[model samples]
Structures are given as structure tokens and as C-alpha cells.
Target: MKCPKCNSEIQTENINIQADIAQCNKCKNIFKISENIEDVIDDNFIVNNKPNGTWYKSDFNKTIIGASTRSPIAFFLVPFMLVWSGGSLGGIYGSQITNGEFNLLLTLAGIPFIIGSIFFWSLALMAIWGKVEVSLDNKGGKVFTGISTIGITKHFLWSDVSSIKEGQANLRYPGGKGVSLVLEGAKRISFGSSLKEERRYYLLRAVKSVMNKNR
Candidate 1:
């Protein structure tokens, strides 16, 4: 195999189960191989191809980074639990209201479940309808919320990005890790809100390195 970016001879440097990480000696382009190479390698070729992620070179020296959209386990589990708990609590509350037993404590207790239902439903809908991506170049980086018209209509270039910080995103019930880009003017924008801890750290390092190189 030849490196897609530099045309250098590709060699298998590491293997694990059905996937192997291949590296190019000339340009140091790395690719993840999961199946027979002959079929996967098309005319356009590719640079990096992780199972649920992507790292590739694009037109005009742009580097694209893709993270997993939704967790496979959370996709079904979250919605199910949200609907179940919301429905059960909502039904009980309704019953209490009818029986003249409604109280502040019950309403307060049900608020969390109602909020969870709304958030999980929104997340599931977004995953089903669109995808998220990040694009970076010599100038700056852009975080795209999703691909639909209603998804991420506007994107701002963070030219003053000084560093990227990693932390937990506690927006939803079972929040995951996130990465935030700290800018020069004390401005911050976060991405990878749904990524795992390790994946978020990896993205943070990758974006930080690219930003440093551009600087």
C-alpha cells in the first residue's frame, strides 16, 4: 500500500485482532486497517480511518477531525430510561393531581425526569438527523454542530485560540467528557461534548498540536 498523502510505501507497524495501525515512513501518515486493504482502498485513497473517527488531509491544507456522534449503548438505553421514568412519574403525578394529593415535593421530584426526557430526546433526534465535525487549517478551527439546515447554521473561526482544555461535560444526565478551546480574549468554545474521557483527551492533544503548529 502507498501512503495516500505522500505516496510512500506503507508498512504494517502494529496489529491487534482484526484491526492494525499502519504507518508511512516517508510522511508519517498513519491509517487504521480493519479489513482487506484491496477493497477498502479506493481511487481517492485515505489517510486515517479509525472505526468511528477520522483524521485526514483535505483541500488547501485543511485537516479534518471526526469524533463519534453517539454512543452505541446510550443511543438505546438513554431514550428508553428517559421515556420510562418520565412516563411513570408523569402518570403518577397526574393521578395525584386528580386525587387532590399533589404536593410540591412530588412536582420537584418529577422535574428531573421531565428534564432528562427532553434532553435525551433532543440528543437522539440530533444523532438520527445529523452529524458533527471539526475542520482546522493554518488559520483557525471551526466546530460544526451538525450537517442539517437547523444544525449549526453558523460557525466562527477561533483564530485567537491559545490552548484547548479538557473537562467533563455535565449538561445531560450522564454527561461525558468535553474539550474547550481557550482563546486570547478569555473566550471559550467547547466541542466533543459526547466523547469518552480518553477520546476527548486525544482530541484535545491533536487540536492543541495543530493550533501550536499554525501559531
Candidate 2:
């Protein structure tokens, strides 16, 4: 198969069946090759230069911009969880208000449900229409998240960041893996929490490469 980055022919000698690693003759990019490399190549199963809306690069420099690739599982799970949790919260809170009894334990127990409901709903919203833009450049890195034309932003200097690594996402059951930036003092900023495993791996590599280059 041709190298995805350079579009050059791959060398047979550089490809090892046992290790499943292939070094592109042109780009020198070492990548994992599935056992069915010929079939995958024929089917165009190689990672695309541009992975839809999840990743991009700037013209000035290799500034990597990553966004969450919406998950199909989130499409189904989020709304159901939202409705269930919201109903439970409403019922419990309403019952307490009507009875004029404030039970601390019940309230505490309900807090998790309430939080879970909001969190999952947010993931659903993100999967449908929400977007988080993560950019890494020579100066530092930035994260922006919001709906189209509206969002929140955060920026961190290179000095402020310790590293970037893969982490488990909050939206666990069906989809919950993501990559996170480890800030100087143990703080973390996570993104791509709903992406598939392959996408997450590519993203983690990109983030790590950029972070390493800058450092």
C-alpha cells in the first residue's frame, strides 16, 4: 500500500509479517500493518490524510487541530440516559419537596444521578452538534468547545503543560475513551472523549508528536 502521508510505494523488505510494521520507502513513516494489508489497501482501509472533521493542520506550521468524531453509540445512549436520570431526579426531588422532609442521604444519593444525567446529555449534545477544537502550535496549545458559532476557550503555554496522554472518558458504557493534556501541576484537559479506538490512537500520536516537538 502507498504511504498515507507521502503517497509513495512501500517497500516489501521494510514490511515484516511477524512484527506487522511497515516503513514507507518515501515518507519513512513506520506504521502498523494489518495482516490483510493487500486487502485493506485494495479497500482503501488506510487512515486518510484528513480524518473527516476530527483532525486538521494549519498552513503556517504543523498546528494540529482535533475535534471529537461523533459516536453512533452516543446517539442512542445519551438521550435514554438523560430521560431516565432526569425523571429520577424530578421524582425524588419532587417527592421530598411535597412531603416537607429533607433527607440528606437521599439528596446525596440523587446528586450522582443528577450529575450523570447532565454529563451524558452533554456528551449526546456534543456527539450531535457540539464541537471541541484542540490546537497545538509552537507557542502552546488551546482548547475550544461549543456549538456552532458559540463556545468556551482555554489556552495553555508550553511551560504550563507537563504532557499529553490517553485517558478514560467520563461517558463510559458505550463510548468513553479520550486523550488528555496533563498540565504542570496534575491538572488535566481532555478531548475526543467520544472517538473510536483507532481515531483516539491517531489523535494521541499527533498530540504527543506536537507536544514533543515543542518541548
Cα error, residue 153 of model 1, in Å, equals 6.6
Model number with the top lDDT: 2
What would the per-residue lDDT of candidate 2 be over residues 120-158, giving only the tens digit for each residue? 776677677766566777888787766775666778877
RMSD of 1: 9.5
Once fitted onto the true fold, the runs of candidate 1 whose alpha carbons sit more than 4 angstroms away are 1-51, 55-57, 75-82, 85-115, 125-131, 146-158, 168-185
The Cα local distance difference test for each model comes to: 0.56, 0.64
Task: For residue 120, give model 2's deviation from the true position in Å.
Answer: 2.3
The TM-score measured for candidate 2 stands at 0.55
The C-alpha local distance difference test score for the whole of candidate 1 amounts to 0.56
Return the TM-score for each candidate structure. 0.52, 0.55
RMSD of each: 9.5, 7.4
